[model samples]
Target: MRSPCASCVSPGVVKVLIEPLSNQLAKGQLDFIAECLHGQESGVMATVFKVSGEIIAKVASRLFLKPDGTVISNIEDELLVQQILVDVQQVLNQGESRVKSYILPSGIAGVFLEVIHPIVPLVVFGAGHDAIPVVNLAKHQGWHVTVVDNRPGYITFERFPNADQIIFSEPQTIQNHLDLNSRTVAIVMTHRYESDLALLRTLLPSSVSYIGILGPKSRTQRLLQDLKSEGFLPKDTQLQRLYAPVGLDIGADSPEAIALSIVAEIQAVLANRSGGMLRARFGSIHGEEITCLMSV
Candidate 1:
């Protein structure tokens, strides 16, 4: 049940084309993809594979494959779909997108894989005036920002107009409201020793990739000491995720400047890069060069 008259002539080499989303995916499929993103699931979106010089077996215009091997497609060729699934797995593992070409009984097939990742989730544990700038910067970068404070009066929409969520809960109950995962980055800036200690006790064992404390080194050490005294000792791996005296060494004094450094550090940690000057790097500012297409 291949797509009717959907074949296209190739120009020998890979020629990527950009088309409207509606042309490649149905409205229902689009909604499903949106749901996956909202749930913070990482997946791959692939265009129809081009067979040899023509896309003869492209029954489905687009395909979405989750990391767990779940596929959403109408393509009838099971073998071809499986091959594309292999490529999808590769893309997911590498966290990169590229074109993969295969040689089949019919001819060569090429598929363009585009990785889709969920929005980074930022949880600001303090809704003080300083947290306002942090939320603003994170939202501008399209990250999902959540502001949590024990004081209902501090967590208000007016202060954090662009925050995705404003939660009011005691530090002890914060875990009940938050679904912290590897995609989450948090900052403990409650400006209260007791509150920071409580939040750290909760976050240390969680799956958050980054946990930044907004105080001096001594304060963070005290928090850890208190947690240890309470019999909740953080492992070495957990301590590695903690960023005390949070933010880059930007000599920031103003709230806005400090916010910039904090946000920048989060970006670097997620990207697995040191927060260093770009001018010092010899390679591309983004990362290593990526090959757009490969035929094998």
Candidate 2:
């Protein structure tokens, strides 16, 4: 029996894009769409159908409309897809969810676009007391959060009722339990030198977009030096993505204050902002344009 298409599935979707009807596309195009959806924060589903109700082509929101109202994807029907993508992009820009329909020149009337923003995922690498505030702050923002620590005593659901997942595992073994992708924001605050070093070694080689290490700048420098001595020379690109001395310099001393700073910094980074005063910055506070599927 043939599998049902993504649109035929039930209600209440997760942060995933499924396109069972995409077998009509080339393998390379399918791969590109997969990569795009893997990094998107706003969930998107686009289905192209014939007037007879047969699904023709289907794709998710990994493609975004450029400022000039064009898209950069390898999918077929670029013009029609671009038009539909523009409509989806407008909904995302307005921070709303909606279903939109369009008619193609072929007289197909069932072409539809559905877009929904998913909760961002955040993984905290330490379950220390300081992590509580971070978890609380992130949960308040409606982000999917996971907290990891090796000590069973330190990482308990009682301490983190809002956390989606609490894993008790060694720093080196975290990859087995958690999957880090381009949209994941990882924060390391184990407060142990060895654990932080191990986590950094593991994360720097992965595709996780943001790696925030809590501590002093000098501490991070020392950690890098140690990693270099161990023959782990991080690439320039990887080093650039690491945010040492995590959180903004808002004179944060208490745990809650620090949490605020850290979350603010992460939000700014996700939005491609400099975390500067809005009055000093030009253009829209949301950035000049929405960069869909671009690396965080």
lDDT of each: 0.78, 0.71
Per-residue lDDT over 1-296 for candidate 1, one digit per residue giving the tens place of the 0 to 100 score: 11212222332343444333453344655665576577667788776545554434662366778645677876555666779888888878777766666676656666667677788999999999999999999999989999999787889999999999999999999889999998899999999999998898889999998999998999899889988899988999999999999999999999999999999999988877899998899855545322232212
lDDT for model 1, please: 0.78
Model 1 residue 169 CA deviation in Å: 1.4
Candidate 1 pairs with clashing backbones: 52-108
Q: In candidate 1, residue 23 scores what lDDT? A: 39
**What lDDT would candidate 2 get against the real structure?**
0.71
- Superposition error at 39 for model 2 (Å): 8.8
Query: After superposition, which runs of candidate 1 have C-alpha atoms over 4 Å from their true positions?
Result: 1-16, 20-24, 48-60, 74-80, 101-110, 282-296
lDDT of 2 by residue, 88-200 (tens): 67765664333344566644433434343445789999998999999999999878899999998889999999999999889998889988877789999999999999999
RMSD of candidates 1 onward, in order: 5.8, 10.6
Give me candidate 2's TM-score against the actual structure: 0.64
